[model samples]
Target chain A: MVTYPGLPGPIICDYLSREASRGRYGPGVEFQIGKIEMVANTGTYLDSPFHRYAGGKDLSALPLDSLANLDTVVIRIGGGSVRAIPRAAFQDVPVQGRAVLVHTGWDAHWRTERYLSGNPFLTADAAEYLVSQDVRLVGIDSVNIDDIDDPARPVHSTLLGADVPIVEHMCRLNLLPDRDVRFFAVPAKVAGFGTWPVRAFGVVST
Target chain B: MVTYPGLPGPIICDYLSREASRGRYGPGVEFQIGKIEMVANTGTYLDSPFHRYAGGKDLSALPLDSLANLDTVVIRIGGGSVRAIPRAAFQDVPVQGRAVLVHTGWDAHWRTERYLSGNPFLTADAAEYLVSQDVRLVGIDSVNIDDIDDPARPVHSTLLGADVPIVEHMCRLNLLPDRDVRFFAVPAKVAGFGTWPVRAFGVVST
Candidate 1:
């Protein structure tokens, strides 16, 4: 997964005292407590409908069937000169009720200045087509599914408005097969939150 | 799930301009961004080996097999006067290579002050027995798996020292069957972090 640029990854600090704990307990018993500070959108994350619409469903309200144990499809857009993924790219795939992942191979530039500029993105037409096909979820291996330079954010607006969740900043899409895999990208069930980081992975049946 | 007392729940704040986005794009194009700040131990959370040992495996280091799609066993301990769960509580069940969940029915007091105090926890002997049995993971429907008053945190020390992950503050354990269930408690893959909140749930075959 591509680490979010400028976002503090994770801060681990001591919470309880090991010496004090050991002294209070036995010699072999030494416990340490830690505290972490992180932003909701720090790394590879999912954006629920509430991320785009104020009254839309938040992370807590999402159904588990939509996020976990999903049939998945991987669309490789790497080695292509076109940056904007168009509707034709998805016309041939069976996207209904599956996690459609667009692998742009842009994760190679993760954590670098190159990752921030000229990243691949899905066009508004592609987002509309995915919505029409009734995809369960959409994911991309890029900084954002929409062009960051475009303040309109048409891709996010089209997909999230239809209650289709989006996973961004994913890596290792190349590791997954082109079709027939189980996908999961569940986030912490935090109420009132629209977006948060997740442990996104695909499970292939051996 | 029991919400940790005094811990801040998710807060969703607006990030981008809805009016500007709509004006820039089409009429229905309005985007809303959110910011969230939460304590890692706020709700039902998983503790990696690093939670107790600084040099041990962090969240990112944990294997997927250890966290997802494991056969689970639920042991109900409600309506009993006992607070300290002993090793004998697990004597009758098949716990080896499974996710053992102790359902204390303490989730009834979730989000209440009663949930914080007088919660059920595992004894040190119980943790040792689970380790000996080679259980994949342990979960409980209580404020914590260890007695919070005991600064020693014997349960955490014993379990985490054995590299067995623990999921605390789980709820709805009663919903799961006594056997033949799939358990998942995946946390965000944040490096250098020992503990973080998770979307803990079980998949029961229909």
Candidate 2:
């Protein structure tokens, strides 16, 4: 489901096939019921605070205590042509409510076209210093943490205007470590919706 | 995003609006980039085994250790007129490799029409006794594990034909606590998608 170069990708067919559920579960009983349309920013997503506040908090007002398990902190910032990323690169982490994530290895230009143009963002003073250190999530292995020609996204308007929760097209993050990571990105609570697509994972302490 | 009565429900518009991002980020900067179309089994979901063996394994071959933070077990079964269930209601716990939820509190008839007529499931000899006790995942708080008027799903063809993964319409499970539960239902690794929709959570040890 990795398709986001101007969205609209993900149409996985079959709403009951396998020879049509073997004619409604006959033969040695069959099953399959896929169906999807998509464009909540295609892959690896997660963006609550109603995707930039309109009376914030959607995706069913987020809380499973701020997504699955949380309490993570990655930071690294390795990989070429350093683009922006200020606030003294998150001043040696201990980022408040944790789930900092920024390992910029831009997911090795995932699914090409150089991952939608020379990206690597986050710097309205690193989103106002991770929303003045009350972070509960903010991820990015690239592709828009703002600076897609800066349409004044200002790091998604200062970390979704402080209700936090971001997580972009992330990828491994060099196998997470640097703080007892344990994040998890859930979605599909959908109430008046505001950004979907997530299966983000993290959980290390090996 | 709770459709699935003949599918299609989730059209959440807005592909960058907030008065069109304040005419492209002018004013005190605005943002919103939503867009969704539905059907991946609408609301609560998960089921890999290519959704039922075509060559099995889908959702990008599911592993974040069998869908996030395992070791769970609820099995309460206490709703009215208990439908099916069996395998002696999971004969005194210790369900081999965890995640065997089934708290038929039928989610207090979730979004009504009695959550689609007569809803508790999981029989086929309790899905072949949790696929011969190798359960790594299998959830339910209602609305299907099998027995949606027996379309011969055979507990979803005997636990997704032994690749074992299935979570469906789950709700709190009467606030879980019958085992050190810590489940988490993830989805969106979509490869020919077999099912989607999830925000199913669980984690107890208070």
Q: Each prediction's TM-score against the native?
A: 0.90, 0.36
Off by over 4 Å in 1: A1-31, B1-30
Model 2 residue B48 lDDT score:
87
| Candidate 1 clashing pairs, residues 3+ apart or interchain | none
The Cα error of candidate 2 at residue A29, in Å, is 24
Quote the lDDT for B36 in model 2.
68
TM-score of chain A considered alone, across all candidate predictions: 0.91, 0.34
**What lDDT tens digits, residue by residue, belong to model 1 across residues A50-77?**
8788789999999988899889999989
For residues B58-91, could you state the per-residue lDDT of candidate 1 as single tens digits?
8999998899998999998959456899999999
- Candidate 2 per-residue C-alpha lDDT over A1-206 given as tens digits, one digit per residue, 9 for 90 to 100: 35565556666677677786687665677767766666677888888877777888888888778876788878887655798888888887788878788888878888888888769887788788778888888888888888787767877777777777898888977877778978888887888677887878787767
Instruction: Report the number of clashing residue pairs per model.
Output: 0, 0
Candidate no. 1 TM-score: 0.90
Task: Report model 2's chain A TM-score.
Answer: 0.34
> The CA-based lDDT of model 2 is what?
0.79
lDDT of 1: 0.82
Question: Model 2 chain A: which ten-residue window has the lowest total lDDT?
Answer: A1-10
Task: Provide the overall lDDT of each model, using Cα atoms, as 2-decimal numbers.
Answer: 0.82, 0.79
